[model samples]
Target: MTTTLQINGRPVAVTAEDDTPLLWVLRGELRMNGTKFGCGKALCGACTVMLDGEAVRSCATPLAAVQGRAVSTIEGVKGPEIDALRRAWTELDVVQCGYCQSGQLMSACALLRHTPKPSDADIDAAMSGNICRCGTYPRIRAAIHLAAGDDRR
Candidate 1:
């Protein structure tokens, strides 16, 4: 089957099985490798992507589910929120292994979009699902705080 979805800001059609996970289509068929595959299960947020401004696990999301919806991967996500996150990530040195940074950034972008000034607890809740093997949770939280303009750290 063929499904068309808005990626980043562009609309593109991909031909794949209806149940094909969006992650495979992204990294395989579409050649959009920014979204990584950490686990086939949705337990890992390594495959997180924005589905209509809400982060979803691309590893478990089917292509058919995203038809006509806007999907924003790390490569395509843009705006003031993401820009601030990028700056904060760099300034705070949030990346460790770097494998999970894309998903981490995507989830952080969504949090900032909904809650521009998130407290530490809010950051913890928003980012709890994303696991970094490098144990950069402290830096990740600090980066979110910095991106949200809440530099109380």
Candidate 2:
């Protein structure tokens, strides 16, 4: 099936199987590799992307489900919120291995978008699904807080 999607404020058209995961369409067909394929299961958030501005596991999300919706990959992250978060990520050295950072950042971006001011627990709750094997939890929390303070909210 050929589907047209509004991704990152842009309209994209893809032709593939109906059940093809969004991740493959984005990375393979669309050439958007920012979203990773970790466990392929929804258990790992390594393939997180923003569907209509909400964090979602693209690896398990069917392309048909998001055909008419907007999908935002890590590459599509922009504006004040993303810029602030990226700076904080770098300044705090929040990434250890970096394979999971894209998903981590996507989740953080969603959390900050909804809650301009979030508590440690809020951060924990939102970020619990995204795992960083290098154990940068402390730094990630700190950076989220720091970036939240600079909210364009």
Candidate 3:
């Protein structure tokens, strides 16, 4: 099947099976590797991407579901929220293994977009699905807060 999706900001047409995971389309067909594959079960946020400005797991999202919809991967994400996240992430040394940072950033970007000033509880709830084996949760939280100009740390 051929599906045309608005990736980042440009329209991209890709050919794949209807049920093929969006992850494969991005990584395999499109040669975009920013989104990682961790569990392939959608349990991990490593495959997270923005679908119309909302974070969705590409591993579980099928090609048919994203046809003609806007999809933003780590490679294409930009703007104030993402810029703040990148700065805070780097300034706070939020990355350890670096496998999950893209997913974490994507999720965090969504959180900031929805809640410009999120509480600790909100951060926890929004980031609960993303797992960091390196145990950088504290730094991640601090980075989010910093990105939001909270400075609660």
Candidate 4:
């Protein structure tokens, strides 16, 4: 089937079966590799992407489900919150090994978009789904707090 999705504010078309995972469509068919594949079961947020402004695991999401919907990957994430998050991630050294950073960033972006100023509990709840095998949860939470303009020093 031919599916057209609004990705990162641009319309993209791909041909695949309805059951084809959105991750493969983004990585293989569309050649957008920023979204990683950790666990295909959606338990891992490595494949997280914003679907209509909410983070969804692309590895388990079907291409057909995203048709006509806005899907924002790490490559597509933008705006002031994203900028702040990126800066915080960089300045605070949030990445270690870098495999899960994309998903972490995507999840963080969604959290910031909705919460703006999240407390530690909020940050923890928001990021609970994203697994950073590097064990950077502390740094990740700090980055989210930093991005929210919270003084974590």
In order, candidate lDDTs are: 0.91, 0.88, 0.95, 0.92
- Candidate 4, superposed: residue stretches over 4 Å from native: none
lDDT of 2: 0.88
Q: How many residue pairs clash in each candidate?
A: 0, 0, 0, 0
Q: Which candidate has the highest TM-score of all?
A: 3
**Model 4 TM:** 0.98
Q: Output the better candidate (1/2) by TM-score.
A: 1
The 10-residue segment of model 3 with minimum total lDDT is: 1-10
- Model 2, 1-115: lDDT tens digits are 7888888889988998989999999999999888999999877789999987789999899988897788888987876778989999898888888999999999999999999
Which 10 consecutive residues of model 4 have the lowest summed lDDT?
A: 144-153
Kindly report which residue stretches of model 3 are placed more than 4 angstroms away from their true locations once superposed. Answer: none
List runs of model 2 lying over 4 Å from the truth.
150-153
RMSD of each: 0.8, 2.6, 0.6, 0.8
- Give the TM-score (vs. native) of candidate 2: 0.94
Please, what are the lDDT tens digits per residue for candidate 3 over residues 31-130?
9999999999999899999999888999999999988788999999998999999999999999999999999999999999999999999999999989
Q: Which portions of model 1 miss their true places by more than 4 Å?
A: none
Record all residue pairs in model 2 with backbone atoms less than 3 Å apart, i.e. clashing: none
User: How much is the lDDT of residue 60 in candidate 4?
Assistant: 92
Which digits, one per residue and each the tens of the lDDT, describe model 4 over residues 1-153? 787889999988889999999999999999999999998999879999999999999999988799879999999788998899999999999898999999999999999999999998998898899998889999998888898999784
**Candidate of highest lDDT:** 3
